[model samples]
Target: PTMEDFLQPGNKQVAAGYVIYGSSTMLVYTTGRGVYGFTLDPSIGEFCLSHLNIVTPPDGAIYSINEGNYNHFPEGVKKYIEYCKQEDKPTKRPYSARYIGSLVSDFHRNLLKGGIFMYPPTASAPKGKLRLIYECNPIAFLAEQAGGIATDGKNRILDIQPESLHQRVPLYVGSKNMVQKLQEFL
Candidate 1:
């Protein structure tokens, strides 16, 4: 199959979701209305509604990213990382840094717990790394529907025009206020 088979903008999707396979298998999705989550019930062999109409908090005390790439990150992202590590209690500074190097895991945690998950442009990956259509789109859609925000540090994720099937993009998604604060740094 050619790359053209996968070239589609995120905004075209009417629904988007993801499944996490861990100690407890879970599915999360949205239909442009709201975000919902279900857990696989092993005994019943069915998905049971676990979270209904999930809503993300506007502010959080966690930041998820691959800090190993700190030296390679963009100037704005670098500053933002420093800001997350600052020692100001008034605004809940010095947020916890959690990075499992797993997009699904990181995004899922931030979605449920409230935080920012960023995959910004770096020296090695000037245009960013996560694919626009498959990787970023679904998560971006869920983020918005769950009362959060998803952006490329500037533009909305769903509004991005896909140039190729595997096009990579910078992604900054999470609670509304947290994402907006990162935008300020950008």
Candidate 2:
């Protein structure tokens, strides 16, 4: 039911994969660069990577989060969102919000474009929403490997240890500069 169940280091991975859920069902996976896409191929029973390393834009300007939980967020989180919102006018950056409700999807976007993805502790949930060991740690590893930064608002995610497997902690990952700014706010 959670990301921890999947993406384990020992688990088999298709290098890259994507699912399409409209009209017809399709599961596309790739073992390396040169992304490959595959349709159900009704006649066969297998997933194929037909698309190669599909070019993804590097200047990602979108963000993702559960805005409905905004009311329960800390002052630092609120301030960060406000800053993102102002990135266009006074800030002159022109960034936009794009929440997909899925950490993988959100992170995938960030992987493509150098944007920020935040899952900070809220007023109601003082700790955070994602698990430190399973979720944040692995994701942080991937993000950092892809030239991004992952932190617990103030410190690096990798620098923290999990007291429990399900332990939740604030997560702020993405562009190195953006992550650094978030730390400053914390």
Each candidate's TM vs. the true structure?
0.95, 0.68
Error of 1 at 19 (Å): 0.6
Over 45-143, each residue of candidate 1 has an lDDT whose tens digit, in order, gives 999999999998889888999988889998888899999999998989899999888988998999999999999999889899999999999999999
Tens digits of per-residue lDDT, candidate 2, 1-186, equal 775554243123325445665555655444433433455655676655444444333345666778889888788778777777774654346567888888877876676666888898887778998987667776676566556778887777877755666778888888776677666766
Candidate 1 lDDT: 0.92
Q: What is the lDDT of residue 48 in candidate 1?
A: 99
Q: What is the C-alpha lDDT of each candidate?
A: 0.92, 0.67
Query: Which candidate has the highest lDDT of all?
Result: 1
Against the true structure, candidate 2 reaches a TM-score of 0.68
